[model samples]
Every structure is written in C-alpha cells, then in structure tokens.
Target: MIIEIKIPTPGESITEVELGKWLVDDGSIVSKNEEVAEIESDKATLTLVAPETGKISFKVEEGVTVAVGELACTIDTDAAGEVALDPPVAAQPKAEPETIKTEASTEKTSSADQRRIKTTAVAREIMEEHHLSVDDIIQGLQRIGKKEVEAVINQPTSTQKMESAPKNLFSRDESREKMSMLRRKLSQRLVAVKNETAMLTTFNEVDMSPIMEIRKQFQNKFIEKHGLKLGFMSFFTKAVATAMQFHPAINSMIDGEEILTPQFVDVGIAVQTPKGLMVPIVRNAESKSIPAIELEIKELAEKARSKKISVEELTGGTFTITNGGTFGSLLSTPIINPPQSAILGMHNIVDRPMAVDGQVVIRPMMYLALSYDHRIIDGKDSVGFLVKVKSLLEKPQLLLTDGKLPEELLLEL
Candidate 1:
C-alpha cells in the first residue's frame, strides 16, 4: 500500500534537480494529487504531487540535488487514517465574555500604537504571561511620574542612535548557499550571450499620456467585460507584436549559420520569481486582442511565480519583453534571451517637459531599450523596430490595425 514517489524530469536536458522545499511535514496525511514538494531544475521549478491519499514520509532532504527519477518520498496509503486530527472546538473550554472582550479590544488597538510602544524583554514576557498588551498595561498604570518624563527626555534620538551605533556589528558575519541549478544555468547563459553574440542596444522614448488616458477612461469597462484590469504590459506587448509585422527581422533568430524567422510571434514575458527569472511565452501575441494578452500574461506570470508553470510554457519564444519599470528602473539595456534576436526593455515613466507644437508641455514619458544581435539584425532594423513600437504604444489604437492607421489599412496604402 506504500507508493514510492520519484523526482519528475523538468525537461529533456535536465538530468538532476535540487529539492526546493516540502509543502507538508513528514508523516502528515496528504490528499491524492496534492502537491507535496517542489523540485528546482535549471529551466523551471516543478512540483511533486501525491499519487494517492496517504501519510507521506520524506526520503531526501530539501536543497539536496537528486537525479531525475530518483526516489524522493513514499506515501503509505494504508496509513491515511493513522494521523491524528485536532479535537472539535466544542471539546475545548470556551473563553469567558470578559476575557474575549479584552482580547478583542487588544486586537482593535491602532497599529501605530502597537508599533510605537517599546518594551523590555522581561516586561514583554510578563505581559504575554497575563495575555496583556502595551495598551492594557498603559490602562492599568496609576500615574506617570517625574522619573518617567525624565526617561522620555533622556531617550536617544534616532539620529543620535545611528551615530553612536557600532559600524561593524554583525558586518563581519558571512554565509554562503549553493546556487540553485536555475541560477547557475542563468549565469552561464548570460556569459554565453555576451561572448557569443554581437549584441547592440538602441533606445527610444514614448509619450505615455495617450495610453494612460485610455486606461483611466476604459479600465472599469475593460475589467467589467474581461474580469481583469487594463495594464501597461498588455499595451506594450500588443505594440511589440504589431510592430514586428513592420520589422520582421527583429523577431528572427540566428540558428547555426541559418537565420530562422518564425511566422508566428510568441512573446516571452520575463517574470521575476523568488527562485529566479522565468520567461513564460504568450503564444502568437500578434493575433490576440489586448484583453486576451492581459489574461494570458496574468496566468503565465502567476504560474511562474508560484512555480507551477511547465517547461513548455517557458520555451519556444521568438522574442522577449522585460519591464524594469515595475521596479523603478529609469533605463537599462536588457540582454537578449537566447535564440531570440531581440528583447524590448521598458523602464520607469517620468513626467518631463516636452516640445509640442512649438510649446513646452509636461508629459509622462517612458524609455524603451531594444537589444539585438547585430550580426543578424542591422542598426536600421533595430532602430526602425523600436521606433515602430514607440509609435504603436503612443497611439495604442494603431495596435488594432497591426501598427497601421485605420485609414491607412482602409485605403490599402
């Protein structure tokens, strides 16, 4: 009745993976198909689920590398009901009304008061022993004395404390951790990209007022209809996809002396997770509506962060988009994801004075950086591609017509 669980292969090339962590403790009852632990491969993080409802036992410790198909744990289906459960609430004594009221009042105290109060270790222990808080002790105090006022006056100011504090306290302490396979692989790929490719970055800026206005005006309707809010990434994603039509070379990659241009645009969105950065592709982005792109990006980003995304979801991207704007990066030349000829980097928006119709106008603007393999893509292609993206983003309506004006498409010009 014991079922042995083996490590699942994350990908074709991943021979081994590090045991990321266990979701449940050993000897705990797990439901059938319940995720028990996560395995970290160089490409992605994958979860191991229980084959059947059972009490599980761990065979390997977390953070240890194990070969694919190696035994990870075992679940004894026969011992499913052996684990004890907590007693019913009725079996325990109920709290008295006064005690419950006091606890409730303590919980209702303002968070600022909770943070502002400082207590000695001994005083904190006594307060805990009597189920008391700073507020409760304050309420019980008979009166404040001259000594207390003196104590308050003598307290060191934050600036004084900072100046007096030792500079090297805990500074010499150091610790090291083994790099996860994913990070190691990422490091190798980054180095390979710098050394192997003739990479060049071109930059451009876009006025975000039009897109921001659209979002502000239609966000409610968009959310009501699509069940998701309008976001900048979707607009940019659609813009990049639409812009690719005008500059197809930006979507092409060099493949062993042959230039491979994919007919479809699978735009990989770079999602940062606790483990590492993962690029989950939005398949055929050029053809999808903005709502659809937003929904898919949401799902893929959620999956990537939760470590539930598959290797297939992370692969086969023709181009990649990374938004450093979310983290407040003003500008950065993003490195290209391998096999993809170009990557678009979106940076933080800033309100600056811009020249408009012979008048100085304040406008919200964002910097865009496109890094490409110069050996395959020329400066003209790179610059044109970026300018096209900027135009599409600035005039979001152009996305609907595949980077052309509605009149242009109607006129067949």
Candidate 2:
C-alpha cells in the first residue's frame, strides 16, 4: 500500500509552510519515523518524518510553499525491499548523516572536468541553503549519465578570487539568490518597528570593574558549581530585572493606544544562528539567580542555534538584550525587537583612562545602548532606568545578591 505523506499542521495560525528541504534522497528506503524533510512555518522549522519504512518520493519540491494537509510526498510500503534500478542510479551503501555536514575547505579534483552527483530536487535545495559545495559532499559518487545543470551549483574555478585579477572585462562579480521567508519576515519586522515606533537610542558607559572583579575572583569556583562560564549576560540580565521595578516603562510597550506593563520580567536574549537572528525569552528572569539565568540562557541559545527552539519560547518578551561585544564590536545602536519597547545593546569592554574621585585612573569600560520606543518611554525614565542598570552592574555584588552581598545569593530583605 502507498502511504501519502501530507504536511502536518505546525499551528492553528500557520496555514501554509515552506517546503524547506528533503533530508533523505528521493527513492531511498526510510525507516519508520525517520526525518525525511524540513517544513518551515512563519514561526518555526519542523521536521517532516517518514510515516513508515518504505521508498519515498517527493510530490513537491523544496523552497515552495504548500498548504497544511497538502501532499508533500508518498511512501510505497512494499518498495523498500524490492526496488531496483540501473547501476549507479540505484541505492548505494547508506552514508552516516554526520558525514553530510558541509565543510568550508572543499576538496578539489585535479581534472578540469566537473562531476555531477545524483540528488533529489529537494536535496539540491538543502545543499544550497547549507552553503555546501558539491565537492564537500560528493564522496565516491558513481556517475553514468549525461551531466546537466538541473540543480548543479558551479564547481570552484581556478581564476583569481582575490585582488580583482587586474580588472578584466568579463568579470563575474555578483550573483542573486531569493530571500527565504524567515529573512523576509525579519526584514518586514525591522522596517515595521522603525516606521511605526517613535524609537530613540540612549548611550551610556558602564564601569565593568565590579563585574570583572567578581568573575575573575570566582571564575573557577563559579564554573565548577554552575558547570558554565561566568558570562556578562547574567549580570546585565539581573541589572535589567532589578531596574525595571523602578522604571517599568523601559520594559513596557504601547499596544495600540494602551501601554501594557508586564509585572514579570521575561528578558529576550538575542541569539544569532545559521538561519537568522532569533530572540528566545528567558522566562521570569527577575526571580531567577545568576546561576539559573546562565543555565537557562545557555539552553535557550543552544536550542535556537539548533532550530529546536519552540515558537512559544521565541515569542512574548518584555525586553531584549543584544551583545555585539561577542563579535568584537566596540559600540553599536541595536534596534528594538517588535512589541517590546526597548532593547539593550552590550559592547566590548575597553580599558580606558578615567577620573576616579580625586585621582585619574584606568577602568575597563563598556558602552551600553538602550533603544526605546519614545511613545512609551520618556527621556527621564529612560535615562534613570539606564542609570539603575549601570549602578547594579557596577556593583554586581548588590545586583547578584540584591542590596547586600550575602554569604549566599539570597536577598537580605
């Protein structure tokens, strides 16, 4: 019996999905519940799995949008064992899935002639999306037919890629590729926030001496206890959470004419993944300890990077924090994520000369940028809120233990 595999519903709101990619080759026998394809909704990417062990075929190609309940592929239940094809076109020994990951340094063949690897229409799209070169993935490919350009990406050329080759006439300098739905969605949201919100970013410098001192003092002990690095994010998150109580508007947003203030602190940590930038919320960040915050942030970030972050985790945040410092940025104005009124941008720490009280001294300083929707937040509130965060971060002992540096992390109140 032939089992038709239809696109499963990602959510009630998600009516259509992009046929992202096929994990398994067309006409390949798959085991029951093996992941065969990728389908992306506006919210998240979902795995489309084989319903049963059989020879599978694609009903629709990748990069195309198909509605929910639409036929994506079919499985011939009996064809798994009996299917046969011409030599070099039939099943070869199954390669381990880990071996298929695209590597940067692709191998080169000595001959100028290009080799074509037989692949499904969907597999070709997957290769393109992953930026995998044919040479990187084609291991011992046995070819028998005429080579065609159905989905063949150009093999690397020997021509000079650097120095512009002394300005030639027939220089192929650029290429165009269609944007994915996720990218389009990101573009639309960014533009929408700019046009719709009365956004303005306030800049301030942080004295990192306190947090730096604490981390340096407890680096090994903290790691031993928490099993994770003592990063700057937890300190910032704690500072933001505490400061929100004094200046709720910094975390509040204008929903139409109404300004909605969330009592609970859900700080969205902006994580950049291979797919795109994703904000996964650390739920109730205000109530969590630095250790707890670090662990949650780690898990959420890993999930986001792996495309395992759920739609729920990606949505509903009171504020966002984006660290450009990780990529060596000295300072940058980060845009606010939508619905949230403000975003905090963290930058690289630099040892700079400063006047400490009556003496001139050097301190490790970091620039903090708060981009807020001016519609909901005032200059006084924004500045005050930032000052509070700055104060907490500067005195991380107060921020971590809340008011007093406890023998433990518990509040003194």
Candidate 3:
C-alpha cells in the first residue's frame, strides 16, 4: 500500500508551508512516528512524519511552498525496504520542502549545474573555519549523474593560487543551483528586520553576583523538583518584564502613526534549531514564575528542535531576547524583531577583575545590549530599561518580595 503524506495544518489560517528539510533521503524507510521532513509555516517549523511504516517518496522539490493538505510526499507502505525516488521525468513531490541542501548550492555554485549543495548560513562559517576557497569546497557539492560546471574565476585567481592551497584540495567542475524556498524567505525576513526598523543598539555591563548566589543556593533543589537546571534565562526574562513595566514603550509596537502599547508581555526567546533560528513566545511572561517560565522555555525549545512548535506559538511576540552567550558571543548588537520596539541581547558571562567600592576584585560580568526603534523608544528609555534589568539581575530578591512568585512555588505537598 502507498501512503500519501500531506502537509499537516500548522495552525488556523495558515494556508501554506515552506519545505524546510528532508531528514530522510528519498529512499529511506521510516517508522510511523519518525520525522521525515520539516515544513515551515508562517509561524513555526513543523515536522512532517510518516503516517505509517513505509518507504518515503518525494512529491516536490526543496524550496517550493505548498498549500496545507497538499501532497508533500508519498510512502510505499508495501515496499519491503527503502524506495529510491525517480529523479525528474517521473513525478513531483508536494510543494518542495525548504531544502537547506538547495540553498547551500545556490550560494556556492553556479546555475549551469543543477545538482549542488546549497551552502547555508552555517556552511559559509564551516568554509571559513577550514580556510577553504571556493575551489577547495566545490568538489564536495556534486550529486551523481548531474552536469558539473567549473566555478568561474571572477577574482584574482593567480594571487589566490599562489597563496599555497592545502594538500588534496583542488578545483573541481560544479554547476550552480537555485536557492531553497526557506533560504530565500529566511534571507528576506532577516533583511526586512534590518531595513524596516529605525535600528540602533545600546550596550551595558551587568554584574552577576546576586543571581549567581541565588542560583548556587537553589539550583540543586530546583532541578531536583523540575528535572531541569536553574538557568539564567528565567531570571533574565523576569528582569526584562520588570524593566518593561517601567518603560512600556519598549513592549509596544508602531502601527503606522500610532504607538500601540501592549498590556501584557509576550516575550520571544530565540532558540537555535536544526533548521534555523526559531523564536518561540512565552505568553503573559510577567505573570509566570521563574520555574514556570523555565519550564515553558524548555518546552518551547524542545519543540522547536523537534519541529513541533505551532504557528500561533511562534507569532504575536511583543519583544525578543536572544542569548548570544550560548554560542560564546562576548557582545553583539542584535537586530530588533520588527514591530516590537526592542530586543535584548545577552552575552557570555566572564569572571574578570573589576573595581568594587574602590577596591579591585574579580566578579562575574556579562554584557547586555538592547536594540530598539529610535522612533518610539528614546535612547534614555532604552538605556534605562537595560539598566533596570541589570539592577533586578544584580538583586533578584526585589521581584521575589514583590509578589512576582507564583502560588505554586509555595507548595510543599
């Protein structure tokens, strides 16, 4: 029996989805619940799984946007094992999933060649880290039976060649490929984020002494009960909410000539997923306890990695928090996630010697950056809000004593 895999509804009113990735190759056999492909709707990335045990078949190419309920792929349930999909001249896959492989090829290869690896945002970093030239990287981009084109020389080839290439690294003929639908959308959104906002970023240093002490005292106890670590994000999130209360403008949006302030805080926390960066919102963040916030955050992050986040979960965020510290960033002027007036960037915490009450001492310090719309939030409010967060982080007891703790935190039963 053949099983038809359609694009599952991401959420209400979402009519289409961008094919994000194919976890299984065309011929791989998969179990009923195993993830086969990833689809990106307007709000989130969703995993397209096999409906039953079968050999997966492609219905579309990567990067095509297909409407919900459209056939994304077909599975041959009766096939004893893996089924190799017939290349073009056979059948098409449902609106192509966003194939990162396609995007990698477009950025790295030329158009004449059809089969190439699409170099994604991370692929370039890999090339740089390995100190590889286009020629050195081109050889690995080829797919079997595809016409290969030599990457055209546009730069000073002689100069690059003279700089001593690595052993076993040689130029190979390769063809260019088109960008995946997801890659194009990702690029457009990031650019839109930069171009649409009156983007300006401010920076400040935070002393982590108070939060560190609090975490050290309660981390073990909290983890024992919650099954997760006492992370800094919960404290930072609460601090952001506390600060936003004083400067509501940062939590507001600009609708043409109007400045619409939100009564509640819906914070978007950036989570790195297998497909790309996904920001999942924690609704009513101001009212959630640290543990509750942490639990929700953990749940969202896990769903993001597993590609189960819903479109609604990824939309309607009033502000965003991106922790570059997780990736070892010392400082970053992050771009604002549009409409919302501000985004807070958290950096790595480093223990360094600093002056304390006229005496030098080593203390943990992390830099914080707030990127905001200059049109709505003045430099003063932005800076002050960051400072407010810093103060709360430096002394968390203020929030705890102020009834910010949820009733559940008091339960002993």
lDDT of each: 0.83, 0.78, 0.76
TM-score of each: 0.81, 0.75, 0.72
Candidate 1 residue 53 C-alpha distance from true site, Å: 4.1
lDDT of 1 by residue, 1-413 (tens): 99999998888777889998897767766778778898998888888999898778999999999999999999998886553222233642344322223545653432234344433333434444555444554533322222333444566879999889577655668799888889999999999999999999999999999999999999999989999889999988898888888899999998887999998899999999999999999999989998999999999999999888999899889999999999999999999999898999999999999999999999999999999999999999999999998888888877777777888888999
Q: lDDT tens string, model 3, 310-355?
A: 8788888999999999999999999888768899999999999999
Which candidate, 1 or 3, has the higher lDDT? 1
Order of candidate numbers by TM-score, starting with the best: 1, 2, 3
Best by TM-score: 1
Give each model's clash number. Answer: 0, 0, 22
Worst 10 contiguous positions by lDDT, candidate 1: 92-101
In model 1, the runs with Cα more than 4 Å from the true position are 29-34, 93-170
Candidate 2 collision pairs: none
Q: What is the lDDT of residue 34 in candidate 1?
A: 77
Better of 1 and 3 by TM-score: 1
